[model samples]
Target: MRSILPFALALLALPAASAQQQPYTPPKHTAPPPPGIARSTPEEVAQQADGGTQIERDRPATYALAEHRRLTRALGTLLPQRKGVVDAYVLSIALDSDPVFGREAREAGKVLARRYDAVGRTITLGGSDGKAPSPLPMGSPANLEAALARIAEVMDEQEDVLVLYTTSHGAPFGVVYNDGNEGFGAISPRRLAALLRAHRIERRLLIISACYSGVFVPPLSGPQSAVFSAAASDRSSFGCAAENDWTFFGDALVNRALRKPQPLEAAVTAAIAEIATWETRGKLKPSLPQQSIGVEVQAWLKPLEARMPKVATAPVGKPSVDSLQAP
Candidate 1:
């Protein structure tokens, strides 16, 4: 991410004639999203009946209208769904503007798209470098909702699956969205569950790479879903430095495990073990990644797994974690 201190200092050094330009757009929230959204249940969310309007919404940045237009065109480009096929619609997002999250999202999208034969059905959102002008639209809650709305309209609910991968910073409350200083918001467990239900997306594979992301597993997981979290509810995952390419959980799971031809269950098992090895060697507190797979998911999951490339791709980028001292 852009260094906050230097960003502020640069503003102070700007020429007086050009000082009117703001460094970044300020967020519209008067306060952070309400606490306790993590504790809400599906029934409670359904009763509200506002489709997540209670939470702080992600608004368009006035300065990034071109990026907003790109989002519109990106959604427009999604190929029409194929009939009688188990088409997977993939939505991979980097909610935070941190370069690490961006890189992880982009790579994860490629891996998933190839695995599921979703080349024309994938949408990736995030900047490769947090400071540069990105060709893709920056990730945000509103953008995600829009993508889902479109996918719901096109895909056959009975034959298709939604694969969502989100990588970002997090809190016990929810996944964090920090697009530099230009955008901010959170997607609580309640909020995400509500979105999926509203879109009628029943078959899903939800992989969340963020601190304390286990909070999502309880509300969103079911007989038709497979949910994987980077850490337990109270723990923080590692390897999210702005200069790095992948977070610890992401590198282990998407970059390494899932790239091989294996069942989802086996891939998750291997990733958890790999993450544990790294944490043990580094002498850091274990993040304790979590997974929940519905028994019913296997009927369709097996077919998709069978389609995976026979040859695994070699991993790219520096490893997310390493032994601090020589083993």
Candidate 2:
């Protein structure tokens, strides 16, 4: 009976052992390779249409030469031989890629020059190509440096006040300097402060129109300077689209408020109010434009203010697409 039971258990164990010894094998079937296309390097790909490698263009040198000539001429015009109580030197720079900024900056410069009787003394730096009749040269950093040097050369460092109005796209880092075709870098607050200090431009009325332009106020402000920014450091301003004629800040501050025969402080206050209304109507965040007038700068600005040409105040209107139409 024991032998019979052992034999039955051994039969079951033998079947298990035989299954473990022989591993399962899958059927061999190869997959077809993916459809192949001709491989080519970037240069070769670019040349496929022409059947030859495209030659790199060397137009930068030519552009540089032309820009240099224009800069020299523009700088020559900004120099005033005789020094006045307030030789208002307007430097209107459009540092954005949008064409609207270029147009707005040029127009604002023209208006400021007329108001201050600084037609020849004004130096405008815009983003337009040299083919057009522009008041100033390109708005590049090098060109700005040269223009500042020219101002220093002509301006009385101690008495004269420099009215610099820069319109651009701004960031937390700094004000952007962009040419539509050729890319440029930003102008940091520190760098701008250094540029002004280097030129000994102590007495200044600096108006910055951009998003987060309040970042410029601290670095640029001093006892002899009046800094006005379009927006708070943490906020963004409105009406800076490519199609718009003027930024919300620019239109409110320059086109509407400053255009009136009023004090600079009063104009800024009025502009702020107008900007608030515009933002409310558009359902946008408030920019909260900033202004810092140093104690010494106020007295200096008074005499300059008196000399400004009295102009009729135009009715303030809401920004519209039709405003983009060329005059």
Candidate 3:
């Protein structure tokens, strides 16, 4: 009987061991290899040295989720259009097919507009007609002005204005339109802010999704408004797909929205966290997003308060929405 008891315990240990050895899941990243950097994983190292690395692979951005959390705790929800003193906004999707930002830019406007009803909505021009090469089209020298005029009519009698923008790439000066010609395209943040100021439009916000977009914050930041840009000043972000769909920032933003609806500030924070967290499986970084400028953002600023998001305060200067940590 004693010998049988020992054997029975050994059998039980074997099942537990097998369960523990089921399988190991590894993390992944999709960053590009810098200059001449040549490094590979242990498994790949042997394959390259012995058999040479295989070429059957997709781009790095095609990676899967890295980590997931589980807890009994749970939570929830909610940009808009303004008119007149505060009218509806002009959601500008600059889809320049030649530069490859059509579908993606348009989608970005749609996403934010649908999610945040407190700001201007998006209005895309071109791309479906295979006009992908041009950046800003038809919006004109008076593009923003014209768009605002239409917004004024939309809001007709409302009292807050907002502008959400998306495009492929840009520099410090302004946004590129669908028009191949760079004829004074894209409304500068400084000018846009000044325009808002002119109206005495109590509340406003601008969401800029493009390369080198950190420029949005400094020019547009104020006590009564906020600006959120997708990338830093000198970095390239993902998403140059055929249809010109969303990039890493877009995907991340959508994912965050799915996890839990939040105020502009919260949603932006969570998305930044998602990309900044790194992994070996993929080489993508959470975009270094920017937020409100130097001034502290008050949660309750009265009527306009409801217009601009109750976002966290970003330090003044470049890249506004950065997370400020306490020492």
Global CA lDDT computed for model 1 = 0.81
Q: Give me candidate 3's TM-score against the actual structure.
A: 0.52
How much lDDT does each candidate structure score?
0.81, 0.73, 0.45
In every candidate, how many clashes are there? 0, 0, 47
| lDDT (10s digit) by residue, model 1, range 161-197 | 9999999998777787766544656678888998999
RMSD of each: 8.4, 25.3, 18.1
Q: How many residue-pair clashes does candidate 3 contain?
A: 47
What are the models' TM-scores?
A: 0.81, 0.76, 0.52
Model 1: how far residue 96 lies from native, Å: 0.3
- Stretches > 4 Å off in candidate 3: 1-90, 98-100, 118-122, 129-141, 153-158, 178-186, 241-243, 254-260, 277-287, 293-327
Expressed as tens digits, the lDDT of each residue in 29-96 for candidate 3 is: 23333222135444433233222111212324422121001100100001233233333344555533
What ranking of all candidate models by TM-score puts the best one first? 1, 2, 3
Local error of candidate 3 at residue 15 (angstroms): 70
Best candidate according to TM-score: 1
Q: Which regions of candidate 2 fall more than 4 Å away from where they truly are?
A: 1-59, 129-136, 313-327
Clash pairs, candidate 1, are: none
Sorted on lDDT, best first, the list reads: 1, 2, 3
TM-score of 2: 0.76
- Model 1 weakest 10-residue run by lDDT: 24-33
